[model samples]
Structures are given as structure tokens and as C-alpha cells.
Target: MSQDYSSRGSVSRIDASISVPVRTFIFSSLLWLLVASVLSLIVALKLQVPSFLGECPWFTYGRIETLQRNAFIYGWASNALFALNLWIMSSLARFELKSSWLPVLGGIVWNLTLTYGLIQVLLGQLNGFALLEMPKEVAPAMVVAFLFAALWPAVAFARRPTGNVFVSQWYIIGATFVFPVITVVAQLMLLWCPTLGVMQALVHSWFYQNLILLWLGGSALSAVYYFVAKESGRTISAYYLATVGFWTLFLFASWTGPATLLGGPIPVWLQSVGVVAALLMLVPTVITAVNIFGTLAPRNGIAQAWNNTTLRFVLVGAISFTLSALLNIVFSTRSLNALVRFTPFGQAQEHLAIYSFVSMVIFGAAYYILPRLTGSFWPSAKLVHLHFWSCAAGSLLFVVAGLTQGWAAHGRTDFAVSALPGLLAASLLLVGHFAFALNALGMLAADKAPSNRRSY
Candidate 1:
């Protein structure tokens, strides 16, 4: 692994052939992430102040919280992956964005629809659940718009030079072509299907899980596989293991969400299947993580060569995967759920999975990929360091706060369906959530500045 990377470092840098749909998607995606991060910051503040925005209908916690999470999940992460995927596909295929305007249009439509959906959520015109907040009509509309935009990438991939297909490219290409199609179909059915009953919850979970895994996780993992291996100059020692893991993740994880609702009013079998899938995820998640970590294990040259933002964030992300897998199993257990299910402990568990592992890895990948996409180096190394440090420390603080207070509030019998107990939990959650939002904002601000700018 180290040897492969060292050689690449010594090789000359290559300028992008040109911007195309791929780069277009990536840059647009990051821009949406900025907007989403800002919204997240607002939501976090609302959690603390409750009336931070003077009781505007759209600015309330219910409204803002829904928007904040959606923005990050759909707006930020999906698009970030989209952007990175487009750029890599373009390079692999040796094609410019076939129609640059397509990605632009897709970006416009995506942001417009997402903004409208957020407004609907804020207006209290939509359901108020975690990833299911977007109304049916709007969700489908966004999907159609993205499909129209994604066509260019499909065409480019088809047209790209045929060569020894890198394992990463295979997944990336498959995800790029099929992802929007899946999202569109699922959402349209969700909107029109009266069959969506308690199964509505099932469908909802399926959509959310697939969106993250197929849409975001697929691309992000592919990029990490490509970059980590390529940058390290190591062809994955166990490429077959990596591929098998991918299939395992996709198959088993598709049925995994109902497990989160186990012991709730969903079908027993739904929960049963989901529970099995959730537990099984450990196999692939660990396998993939090991493959990446092993490749980067020899720090002899990586520290100096792949040393900057790209590798550092990747390492943090890689380590976080193990934590997420273990936590997923722990939280999914029925024995542990009695006290933690509705408590901040659940919140702690999810945050570390998304923010610590998934988001951070993508962040690291962006530190590397975005510079190539944007035709400029990161604005500030010191700022990047600040972003990494404050976020890592604050998240540690937040997760600890969530678990400790969750244990306190939930463990005690005094916690019942009253506003006071709710307030206690809410307040503790607020502190940790605020810390998270502040650090994310700092990172966003730093990304826009020059790499040599004044430290945060």
C-alpha cells in the first residue's frame, strides 16, 4: 500500500481534461452542502433557544430540525457523493460532462425542490419523521429532475474508454446509473400507493436506508476505495473480499431498517428480518474497513506523502466505521432498548455513525477530490486542522453528553410522558447538538477560505 502511494506522489500531477457533467455535479453538490450545513446550524441553535427566530412558523424546532436533518442527509451527503462520483466517472471515461447544462439543471431543480420541501416541512404541511419528512409529491418531483440530470453521466460512462476496469469504477458506475432510478420509483410509489400503511413505515425506512446506502454510501465507499488504494499506490490486496462485501452490504442492508423499529407496532417478521440484516452488516462493514486500513497501515511515507486533509480525514472515517458497526449492534439489541430507544443515547449512536464516520470520510475525500474539481487547492490547512479538531472533540463531548444524560433521564422511573422530563432530555440534547452544529459551520467556513488563512 505504502509503496504504491509513494510512487504516485513522485509522479507529476495531471490537470483535469476539462469540466463536464461529472465535475458539474460534484461542485453543485458541495454548494448544496454549504446551504444544508447552514440550515443545520440554524436548527441546532433553535434547539438551544427554542424561539431563536421569534416563533416564525418555519423556524420552530420541529420545522427546523426536520429540514436540518433532511438537508444533511439528502441535500448535503447525497449530492456530495453525486459530485465526487461524477468527477471520477468523467476521468475514468475520459469524457467531459456530455452536457454541462444537465448537471446545472439538476442542481437547480434539486436545490429548488429541496428548498420548497424544507419550506413545506417548516410550514407544518408535511409529515414529521426523520428521513420521511419530505412530502410525496416533492420527493418524486426531485427524483424526476435528478434523473433528467443523471442521464449525462450514464452516457459518459458508456462512452468512456474501455480498459482494465478498476473494481472501484464498477461500483461507482453502477451506483451512478441506477441510484436515481431507484429513488424515483420508490418515492412515486410512496406518494401514490394506498398500500403504504404501517408498511408506510416500512417503505419509508427502505427509502431512507437505500438512499443512504445505494445513493450516498455506495458512491462514498467507491471513492474511498479508489482514492485510498490509488493514493496509497496499492491495488486492494483483497479486491475479491471488497466486492463480496459490497454485495453483502447491498443485499442484507436493504432489509435492515425495520430492525430500528423492533418491539414497536410494525410486523414481527419485518423486525425479525431487519434485525438479522442489521447484525449481519458487521461482516461487510468490518471487512471493507480492514481492507482500507491495511492498505494505509504503513505510515512510513503516508504521513509525509498523503499527509494533508485527504488522508487524515480518511483515517478518522475508517476508524469510525468500526465504532458505528459495534454501536449499531448494541443499539439494535432489545435488551438495551428499554432505556435508550427514545433517549439521547439513540441520538448519540446515530450521530457517531453519520457525522463521525460517514460524513468525516466524505469530508476527507472532498479535501482531496474538490481541489481537483474546483481547480484550486484548499484555502487553509490550519483551518482544516481546526475543523477536524474542534469537530472531533466536540462530537466526543456531545456523544458523551447524549449517553450520560440519556442514561440519567431514561434510566430513572421519573421519566414519563411529561413536558418537564422532556425538557431535561431536550436540554441535554440541545447542548450536544449545538456543539456539533457550531463545529460543522466552522468547517464549512474554513473550506471556503484560503488554505493559508488565519486559524479559526
Candidate 2:
């Protein structure tokens, strides 16, 4: 019953089976992206003009900022991952999802619960933790919903009919297992059961970093591994290095969280361990960079980077990953951490990771996955280009502004000087998101209008 999953000429059984669920997740994520972007714009505007929403309690910078970030993480990022990872795992395994209704149901529940949580956030009912800000009331439902959505991927991998396990599968499977564990532990320790004094911070830090690196970063890297090879028509160079990279990331990434509290109330030994673990992450970074860039080597990659939209996005994501990793290592150092602890540079590093590295890779994967799933080419090539540039430019501008703001901490006390770039970044990001939403929705619309659909 097994068939090769490599053929893209027609929708496979696997694609057919998962289509509704994947589409559900994708559309939900697009809606959330719009919500997050608007919130982001409001946040940026408030930064620039503090009195803009001063009268509204709901729009207060503190509350809205948390709302926007959570909306992005839980809403945009999580749903996108569900769609991408589901397709990737099922495609790689050549396994038809027997219970497609599971993910569809799960996606609905997840989004509905997240909506309620965000409302609570606006009402100031939050945990006050970075990245884990959603009210504890919503945690269990979201977790259960995620498991329902995510379980099929693991089943596909374990029950795969043929072929050796790919590196991308390794990352996906690892993430599927790791995320729930950390999320449960963090919620229990930080919210449900509650931990003692500094331990709460420690758990939050551990959970936060792993959520970024292992859960989110793991899924992004999985996409990168698959797309870079698929688009380049070349096997990942130095494939053995992938094992090293994957294992190193899985083992070391969890410990590196403590480094965020280097000078804080955390134990010195724990901080030192985090520092070492963070530095060790360099091993995987260099390994991944070599494997990816090496595969995209010579003139072929350069040409693909220009001609292939998927390759272009994946390549930029690869570059961003390297930069984010390097910046992470740099910031983990004691001297630099002391200087930039409470600064915008820290936020800038996060923006680079979430927006530039993870989001770009997901975008590239979506471009490839959606067309295959829908049996249609993108609605307009122009919209695709516009989305890419707007997002790329916006991400760069935000990161640049953050770094500059951090460095100018001593000299720049003026609000206008600090907030102007952020406002511009937010505006560009909003435009880019609109372009993406239109293009994505148009593709779905074109799918319905068979006369309008184009060949892949």
C-alpha cells in the first residue's frame, strides 16, 4: 500500500487525508497573524505616542504587548507548526492520516481556547511570565488540544511503512515529545502547583528557552532540512553531521535556559552550566550552517536563491538561524549579559529568532506545502514577492532598532528617538501580513475555482 511521497504532480493520499485539517490550521493561523500584527502596530504606536491609547485600560502597553506576543506564539506560530509539521511528517512517512478529524477538532479547540486566553490577558488575568502569559485556566485545554492535533505525526513516524528515518523526522518527533513535557512541567510548577521563590523563574526560563529552541526551533529546522534539500535537488551535504546537530541541540538546549539568569538569584553553578550548554549549541549551529550552505553551494544555490521563492525564504531562514545562534552565544557571556540584561537587545535577539528564523522557514515550507496540498500554484507571483520583501525588511528593521536602542541606552533617553524605528517596523510587518493573507486565501479560492487553478 506504500507509495513514494516524492511525487508532486498530483495530490497523494496522504495529502488528501490531511487537507482539511491542515487548511483549518493554516487559515486559523492567518487570522491570528492579522490579529497579532494589528496588536503589534498598536503596541508600536503606543511606544511612539504614549498617550495614543492612554485612556484604554485594555490597550495599555504592558497588557497589549503580552497579548501580541502570546497571540503570535500560541496563535500564529503554534497553528502554523501544526499545519506544516502534520504535512511534513505524513508526507515523509507516506502515511495517510486515518483520523483527520482529530486534528481538525483539535485545531478548533486550540484556537477557541487561545481566543479566550487572549481576552483574559486584556482583562489582566495572566500568569505574568514571559511566553507563558496565558491564564492557567486555558492551559489544560490547549495542551490536550495540541496533543490531539500533534499525535498523528508521531503515529505516522512510528508506523511508517518504508524508508530510513530522515533527519527532519528526528526533529519533528523530538519536538512532538518534548513540547508537551516541558509545557506541562512549566505550567504545574509555575501555575498549578507553584514553585518556590527563584525556582519559579528558573522553571520559566528553562521552559521559555526550550520552547524557543527545542519546540519552535526544532520544528523550523525540520522544515529547513526538508525544503533546502527538496528545493535544491541535492541531499543535505555531510548528512552525518545532521545526527550530531540534532542530538546536540536536543541535549544542550534545555540547560542553556539558565544562562538567561546569569547575574540573578539563580545558583552560580546552574548559571555556569547554562553558559556551557549555550556555548555547546555552537556545535549544532556550525554543523547546520555547513550542511545547508554547503548543499546550496557553488552557483546553483545562488541561482536558486534568486529564482526559487521557496529556496529564497529557506536560505534567509538558514542565515537568520546562524545569526540568532551567534547572537545567543554572545549574549550568554557574562560581560555582555551584564551590559544588555534589561535592554532592548535581548528583545531584538528574540525577534530575530521568532520572526526571521522560525517564521521565514515556516513561510518557505508553506509555499511548498500549500500548493501541493491544494493542487494549485500561488495565486499571484507578485504577492509572494511582496510578502517576502515586506517581512524580510520589517524583521531586519525591528532587530536593528532593538540593537540600536539597547546600545544607545545611556545616551538616548528620548522616547521619540527610541520608538520611531519600531513604529516603522510594525507598519511594514502589517503590510507584509496582509499580502500573505491575500495570497494564501486567494490560493484557496482558486482551488475552488478549478478554472483559475494553475499547475504546480
Candidate 3:
């Protein structure tokens, strides 16, 4: 007899099978988020007041910045994405996950390795590359741990009961396959073998761009597609365009890496090609934005749409994703790039894409996923609102300040005036991080309180 796990009522079963691993990932991610936020605050403060932590070697700006980036990417982003991807794939496949212990074990190893790697970074053993700072010795273990964590989900996707795979599944699967290859290859080339001269810069630049676009960007898009479709209860508009958009991103995004290296030692022709690729990225961006926005349009009413906190966050993130793409395209242009290349505009753009777009969408996904997994609603709408508003406001403040500083620094030689805006931006970001941590803690506490009360 064929095992039938595709019943519409199998959500509980799916949740049950995946809950342990999912919760593990989420809880660990939140904890890391708090740690990363503290690191970020320190990095921000150092920018404004260089002597604030100057006495400590571990607290130096370079080490702290590297630690913060690694923490956010590996600690927060990796765990959350794994959780989201697992849930999305399982739900779409209409099958309970098999061998859940694999992921749980994988998660334990992943976190342990991450902790060790982070400590190494703090001890000034950094690889001196953006997003690739995790030590080479630990790199292979991370890859192994990730594969361990990701294996079950990939198997579930392959053994999907449903033949009709959705766009979300496509993106998640693509990301799952792509991330490990990119990570291992990048580490080997840049960290282990050590590429020659400018080649190292090129590889580093390529790795960073691909990490953001293929892994983070792909995962964020998957969350957006899944949540927007589920919450809106609407079919994606121009569904065929999603295929086009996905292919466009997969094919062209790698080429956009050289755009960051414009005016560097790389060939002018390569930079020009990157510029074209970056500009062409707008195609997929527009396609995705239009498709998702159309699905998210008020099918019932505006008030109803606004009432859904998850949808609201996803909407904001979707908009930011589009805006980020546009900004990237504009900045890739020689004239605009020449103006903003040395300024805080680059940081502003990174914040917009990573935190505003990617993290916000993941937050929305978590909001939707957590309640179902725990069989409970969020503890407090007030806290949710606080988290949302603070993040939104702080991101806006941070981006605006960065842009302002970028514009101001264009002509001036002294950076004193420009640094003021960065200080303000950092303060706003700290407040936002506090709000996020508090909201997460409140949710966890609330989730646990009912059980404790029952026992008492």
C-alpha cells in the first residue's frame, strides 16, 4: 500500500514531524540575533567614537565588524532560512518530514561550529573578507553541518507527494543546492589556496554578491512567495513570469558581482558587463514585485489586509526589495557609482537589501510559522507593533542618514561632518535591535507560560 501523507488535514502531522528541528533553529536564531545585535551596536559605536572600545583587541573596529557580519549571516540568517525553507518545502510537498533527527543533529553541530568560528573571529583570526571571515579550518565543518541540516529537507522535496511544485519550492530548492557549493568553493579559493593578487579581490567580490543574491535573496523571495500566496489566498498573477524571473536571477545575478569592482584593478570590459547585468536585474525585480504585489492586493478589503501583520511586513519588504534593485541599478551606472562608491551609500544599500528587505520578509515568515508550530497566537499585538514600527522607522532613519552623509561627503575632504549622520543611524539601529529582541523574548515567554501555568 502506498503511504498517503498528502491529506489536506496533515498539517498537524507535518508540523509535528518538523517542530523539534524547526523550534531549535528558531530559538537558536533568536539567541544569535541578540548576540549579533550587541556586536553590531559595538561596531556602530566604534564608528562614532573610535576610542570607546579602543583598549580591547577583541573590541577593535575591524574584528567587531567582522564578528557582527558573521554572526548575523551565519547565526541569524542561516538558521532562520533553514527553518523557513524546511517549513515551506514540507508544506508544499504535503508530506511529513522523514528522519527529523538528521536536521536536529545537524543544527547542533552547525551552532557549535558557528560558536567556535565566531570566537576565532573575535580573537583576531579573521580571513579579512566580507562574509567570508569564518576561518578556513572551520569552513569544511560548516559545509558538512549545513549538508547534514539540509539533507532531510532536500529529501522531503524530492519525495514530494504533490507533483505540482510551486514557485516557492523552486526558489527554496535552488537556494538549498546553491549555498553549499558557493560557500565551499569560495572558502577553498580565497581562504585555502589563496588566489593571486587582484584575482583574490575578484573572487571575494563574486562570492559576496552571489551569497547575497543567490542564497539570501533566493530564500527571501521564497518566503515572500509562500507567505503572500498563503495569506492573500490568491493565485500569483502572471505565474509564468515567475519562471522567467527565477531564470533571469539565476543566469544574470552572478555577472552583477563585477559591478562592485568597477574602477578597481579588474578589466574595464568586465566592469561594463557587470553594469549591464546589474541594470538587467531590474527585469526580474520588476517581474517579482508586480507578481507579488498583484497577489497581495486587497482581495477582500484594505482594512483586512492591514490587519494582517505578517502580510504588512512582507509588503514592506517586497517594496524595499524592488527599491533596492532599482538603487543598485542606478548606482551601477558609472556616473552615479563614481559619486557614491566611497561613501556610506554602499552601506545604505546593503542595509536596505539585507535588513530591510531580507530580514523583514523572514520576520514575516516567522510570525506566520511560529503560531502554527506552537499552536498559539502571538502573545501581544503591542509588542509586534513595537517590533514592526521600530524596525521600519530605524531602517528609514538609518538609510536616510547614510544617504545624506554620502551626498555630503561627495565634495568634502574631512569626514567629521559626515560621521554625525552615521552616529544617528547607529543609535536608531540599536533601538530597533532592542525592540526586536524584546518582542522575540516576549513571544517565547508567552509560549512557555501556559504550560507552566497548567502545571502549577
Candidate 4:
């Protein structure tokens, strides 16, 4: 009897059987996050010690902030999702890559864009809007890189038998296919083929929201659904219900970003709709989170056994998925929104979404991916533990400090350290940065070689 795991529509096995390219993508993403994390800290430090790295034009706060965002979002988060989607497609279709070269090319282009984009940002020509900071030149490159990158999985899934679609597959495969399409269209319309006076502000808002919710956020959720459901060892009781969640989310959350940019000059209707849609988004996010966590409820049993690095990282991601969504909703509120619009609080929200929610999921995927690709477990479990703790602790501290200090700045609280000391907010951020740096070092040092194969 060929113990047919696929027959039952199970993808649990794929976690243990990823290829080298898939694994490399995972590692590279972590590396990006790890490095970007350091830049974030340095940027924070520059806040307090304005003259610490004085006149080193390249190391200015402005430059480092942009670099940190680029590395974390595009370099780290995007790469991780790209790699995991490849693995998911391969498993769903039961097919090996026809040519890994395409993926390699994709990765090259993606990294090149990140490198070039950072250089431009450091040189101070970045567009510099909250969440839309990547310059137009770099944005177009991202479109090309992402399109090329999305192809591998498109091929992988295309080859699969239609009957094999699992709930996880829908989100994973569908998201991979959807992202390139949405991003490509958004980039073209918003950047390349601009139509003058055609609700430019509205279009811009839609593009930003979709890039995040439709492309990045959707991709992030797709992986969470897969890993969480799989890790839970339960076949998400209601696949159809999930489709309901997806489409509803697509329709509602898709239009809310422009609204989030409320108080700006967009039409009243657009902003109003955004506020409503943002709240409505809670429906999907909450439903999905409840279902996933419910499936994984008695989390101790099977999860305890696979206390592997990959599982732990993903678990954090899964939990964060819900938390970040909740945070987005809070920030989405006009009452709270006004306070955090341009403050570090907005940065905190992005980091939580990208770092804790998205990156954590990718980290989990890497943990599961590396052992198979390299034909070895991570060199050290302890090292992985260190990486895990450092990242977790650092992110928690950063978000908490940023939000609190941001409010202090906004409120102009006389008692708030920031009111008395000009450096108070920045100083809090610097402390968080120091913690972030320690975590990054932990990530770099986490890799280990097999002990017995000293000469290999």
C-alpha cells in the first residue's frame, strides 16, 4: 500500500520536503529582516545621539529609516512569501520545479531592486510618504521582479490535478497568483501609466491598500492559514467558509486604505467607505483567526512534538496575524488615527505587521524548510532558540515603546518624558533599537553546521 497522504488532501508532509531554492529564499528573507533590523536600531540611535555618527551623510536618520523599511518589507517579507508559496505550490501539485533557474533569476532581480532602492533612499531621493516611500524608479523595478518571481508557483500549480485543491491551497496558490496580478496592475496604473486628474489621490490610496492588504497582507495570511492549519493537524473544518472569508475580505478591506488616509483631500465618500470597510475587515480577520486557533486549540499535543524552530516561528506568526489585524483596526479609527498619522506609532504598526506578523511566519517556514534543503537540521537548536527569543522580545519592546512614546509626543503630555526632554521619544526608540540589534546578531549566529561532518 502506498501510504497515500495526498489522497486525503494533506500537505503536512511538504513541510518536511522542501528543495534548496525554497530553503535559500527562506534563509535570505531572514537575513534581510535580520540586517534591516540593525539599520532600524541605528536609525533610532541617531534620534538621541544626533552627533554620534555626525556628517556621515550615508548614516543619517532619514537614510537609515528608509533603508530599514525597504529591507524589512520588500527584502525580508516579500522574499519569504515568495519562497514559501513555491514550496506550497510544489506540494499541492505534487511536482518538482521544472526549472529552478527561473526562481534563481527572480531572487536575483528582487535582491538587486532592494539593493538599488536602498542606495537611492540613502542618497535622499526617496518619495518619502508613509507606506509609499519606495521611489517610482524602484517601484517599477519591484513590479518586474515580482512578476518574474510569481511565475514559478504559477507553473507549479498549473501542473496540479484540479481535485487536489485544499483550503490552504486556495489561499496559498490563489494569493500567489493574485499578488502579481494586483501589484502589476496597481504599479502600472499608479506609477507608470498615470492618468492625470483621474482621482489620482483615490487611485494612490487604492494602490497602497491593495499592495498591502491584497498583495503583501494576503500573501502573509495565505501562509499563516497553511502553516497554522497544517501545524494544528486539522483539516480546517470549513473550507467553503474560508472562501467566504477570502472574498468578503477582498471586497471590503480592498477599499479601505484610501479611507484610512482620511482628512486628506479625497472625496468624502471614499474616506467614509474606507472607514466602514476597515471595520468590516474585522469580520474576516476575526473569523479566520478563530477558526485557525480553534483548530490548533489543544496546541500542546502534536505541536509539542514538533517543537522545531519552524513550528515555533510560525506559531508566533499565526498569533500575530490576529493581533496585527486588531491593531490595524484600532489605528484605522479616526479618533485614534489622527494621533498616530505621522508619528512613530505608524511605524510601530508597520513593524508589528511586517516583523511580528509576516516575518515571524516566514521565520517558521525557514525553520521547517532549511533542514530539508540543506539535508541538515539547523546547526543548533539552542541558537535557534536564541534567535527566537531575541526577535520576540525585541519586537514586543519596539512596538510597545513606539506606540506609547508616539502618544506622548502627540498628546504633548507635560508629565511625559518627551514633553520635558526633546530626546525622550527618540531615547525610548533607541533602547528598542538596541534590543533589536541583539536579536539580529542572534539571527546571524543561529546557523550551525552538523558537528560530525567537520571536514565536509
Top candidate on lDDT is 2
* Candidate 3 local lDDT, 179-248, one digit each (tens): 8888888898898888888888888878888889888999899999888878777888889899999989
Cand. 2 TM to true fold: 0.95
Where is the poorest 10-residue window by lDDT in model 4?
A: 447-456
Residue 331 lDDT in model 2? 88
Worst 10 residues of 3 by lDDT: 447-456
What is the descending lDDT order? Answer: 2, 3, 4, 1
The model with the greatest TM-score is 2
Off by over 4 Å in 2: 1-10, 448-456
Cα lDDT of model 4 by residue, 72-187, tens digit:
77777788788877776666677656456666677778888778777777777666344446667776666677776766666766677565665555666556665656656655
lDDT of each: 0.63, 0.87, 0.80, 0.64
Q: Which pairs of residues have clashing backbones in candidate 2?
A: none
- Stretches of candidate 1 exceeding 4 Å from the true structure: 1-31, 49-54, 151-153, 299-306, 411-456
Pairs clashing in candidate 3? none
Q: List clash counts for every candidate, in order.
A: 11, 0, 0, 1
Residue 415, candidate 2: alpha-carbon lDDT: 57
- Candidate 4: stretches off by over 4 Å: 1-20, 130-135, 193-201, 298-308, 411-456
TM-score, one value per model: 0.81, 0.95, 0.92, 0.82
**lDDT by residue (tens digit), candidate 1, 326-422:** 7877667777766577776777677776667667777777666554433344555555666667556655655665656576665553322222333
lDDT of 2 at 413: 63
Q: 1-456, model 2: which lDDT tens digit per residue? A: 244345544666667788889999999999999999999999888877889888978878999999999999989998999998899988888887877889899999999999999999898787779978888988889899999987778899889988678899999998888888998999999999998899999999999999999889999999999988877778888999999999999999999989999899988999999999999989999999988898888666767765888888888888999999999998899998898888888888999999899988888888888887777678888889899999999999999788677867756667567767888999999999999999999877666532322233
